[model samples]
Target: MGVSVARTTVATKTGEVGGTLTNGLRVTLGIPYAAPPFGAARFREPQPAAPWDGVRDGTRFGPVAPQSAELPGAPAWRPGDEDVLTLNVWAPADAPGPLPVLFFLHGGAYTFGSSAQPDHDGAALARAGLVVVSCNYRVGFEGFGHVPGFPDNRGLLDQIAALEWVREHITAFGGDPAQVTLAGQSAGAGAVVCLMSSRRAAGLFRRAIVHSVPDATFSPDLAAGLARLVAEAAGVAPTAEGLLSASPQALVEASDRVVARYAADPDSGPLHYDTVIYGPVLDGALLTADPLDALAAGAGRGVDLLACHTTEEYRLMHQVGTMPPATTEEDLARFAAHWELPADLVDRYRTLMPGAPVLDVYLALAGDGFFAAHTARLAGAHARAGGRTRLSRFDRRRTRPDGTPVRAWHAADTPFALGTLDAAGVDFLTGGPADADDHALSRRMIRAWAAFATGGDPGWEPLDGATGAPVHVWAVPADRQEGPAPAHALWHDVRAVLRL
Candidate 1:
């Protein structure tokens, strides 16, 4: 893990780029994969990168896409530029041959995340013996805003461009492009699902790892209506020309206001306010059909798949205050009704977890509806389509520095999988100071992930449709356990009733 202060350079198709070798890992940051999406290029498909002459320094991170400064516990708003189509790469400094690659996408509900987040550092994963990559794409109005005369889902197009770049240039950085695996969390996982169905993204990778894929897709009508709301907030017309005239900061603020309004009064619009406002649109050209529908039709026929969710994915929403804490029986009933859930759903949950706190009950229902159910369905579909699929449920709980308990909430497995439990913000999501047990769990997860990237088994059996081993549970004391638990069956039934 010794740091090599000397600069290292690699020749990519666009040009020679400089990087740094730190602790046995070479990291190249902020290499643009496409032309800047500014002015005329806004809301359009990503274009090829402008070739450079001399070696360009790629050691520093680039500015993220224009976005609101409203994330909880984040620092003061730092305005980013429109020219933010960049990516970062981490690979072993002295690998004898090109290693397998893992291309990751960051999740911010499709609106508010950047690859530059400290927790997303790929060095640890690279040290574990793979070429790890992360990229930044447009978000919010600049990425998903549906104005007239503009192509839809431009963010996804940016991702496709980055993947294509990897295909062309990763070998120079000691990565085997043919053995690539695409992995993501939350909205990023949703993007992976979308890409699995995208004709544009076919054969970009050989394997997929999707975590906590939320139910967030907007119909064209819903996207258009949301665009009008964003336009009105920015004091502009809903047309591309009118939106293009506004400042990037204005657009960010306008998108933030629209999100806030949706949070405050979720029922005010045709869209379901409970879901993310900005996400991949079911535009026929980019995304031919719903991801599930596409998967059912064997869209990702040859790809290996690993899909999973935490035991309590909804706690993150409650922790962030987007959803209220459920307390009374009346509160449970209200939540059920709000989501148009069947009346008997609450009683079913009560039966499933007798004497459980109302908050826990509510979390169970919401978690299944939002994450677990869809992920399970996606796994089943992939398995049915003759693809190798593995499923898991993370159940590790920890105490924060302040002694507050953090359950297996959304994203709790991220630090473990990345082998970055000591990183900042991990303590908040996964409690304080990871113990020996935590480190052991992290090693197991990292090993499994890296093994999967290497086209090897992850020390667990693939999900079996006939024998009913639907999920592998990851927890303390016991690293892995096969199960077709009653709770999972109950959740499947609940999701069926709610059509989630």
Candidate 2:
């Protein structure tokens, strides 16, 4: 088919080409910058497309990189067979002067998610007087598999290509390419951290905000094992040929089953580690090391960092309609076997969160393991590395009518953060005004994100240069601030008890 030039400027994010939206804001989606992975391209590092002729159809969102959640034999990966590295953009109409570019990475444990989710509504954010762009890259086996002859982390390369796209073409959309800020939640948050830590990612973005990052780093051996198992399950040769011959449906199905295997373990579920289907790999190339390890060693290359989490980070997972019991002794044993975290941590977590059911303890342990403690450690490390960093905690917790405390769950900040508390897109975790505290706190956080993306300080107390006690309580009314610990931790001295 012939590529036609259109009114909007069609471009690539990283290496994927995207089309533009013809609405109020000059929006763009699904332009390809990389070759499709359907054939020999599978299991190899991403390769740039040789550029297209004519103005491509710079409009509409494209199919995601094959997700197993969509059901077997479904056309999960569609929208033409080529061009998987694409980005969507929303810029003000008749815009004047230089606008800042906000780049977003979608969250799905590095497995399932698309930048086109309505909740991430870039129109509102763009309407707030900024140029917003969301993007897609490879996920699962296609993105993370560690082929014997090829390097891993092809997905991250896709992100780099997208950022490069912003740097090269965002100016055409009325944005200042030099003033780009990378923003994402969950797996996307982990992507932000990866970009910051990568030496290859130097000068790609000026700022970053990561929400509830799920430890994206993995040992090469672990990644290899995951690839081998999944590749074999699909009846493929576990080599480049095997992957190329396997259909996206087969690959996605294998990935979903693997995710199911790890669903019982809360930490494993969020990290996408249980299935080992696909994720960032520490393969000695593209990625040099894990974020925690890299940051401590002063290897983040000095990207300004802003990190935060909801009051109750994991409650959303439980509220999920399909959520399973991610917390059981079986999970702990698996965790112990994997991380070598002394099998006692399973029982220890229970003691710390007394009076709660298995799910609560499961939630707490998963939260701490995935985000809470990491936030603390990352802030201190960034400070020690002489980089600008700030921290915040969403202190909005509500007692449900059922008398169950949902607190600030994983994505509780979205409705509040996007200023769409009653927006129609997400009716699962919440409906109506967030508990009184959430509404007030949401304003603080939303503004905080806007301000931090524009300036270094988030209008809150800077993290301690010494004591490391500077987790800003981001809630309504400055007089009452609280961090990530349980609401009644001081009353029962939860930390002290856990030490036992």
lDDT of 1 at 105: 94
- CA error at residue 358 for candidate 2, angstroms: 4.1
Candidate 1 C-alpha lDDT tens digits along 1-500: 54457678988989999999787778899999999898678778898989999999998877788876443333333564655899999999899999999999989888888887777889878988999999999888788879787888988989999999999999999999999999999999999999998988998999999999977777788788888888899999988789988887898888778767766663443233253668888888898788987887899978888888898898888887877666998767766766667787778778989989999988888888778777887787778777788988899876666887768989988888888788767777786678998999988888889999997467788877554465788888666676654555554544422111
User: TM-score for all predictions?
Assistant: 0.93, 0.83
For candidate 2, lDDT tens digit of each residue in 1-500?
54334455534433333444344577776666566655666666667656665566665676678665442122255534456667777888677787877888878777777766666767766766778888888887667777778768878888898888788878877888888889888788888888888888889899888777665477777777777777877888877667677777787777676656665555552333223346687777777877766876787636777877766776666565344554566754544455444455656766776777766766676566656656566666776777777776666555567786546667666656655565544555453355555566656666676677666667766665455556776554442444435432222212111100
Q: What is the C-alpha local distance difference test score of candidate 2?
A: 0.66
Q: How close is each model in CA RMSD to the real structure? A: 2.7, 6.0
Model 2 spans > 4 angstroms off: 1-24, 70-81, 261-276, 321-339, 343-354, 420-425, 431-443, 476-480, 483-500
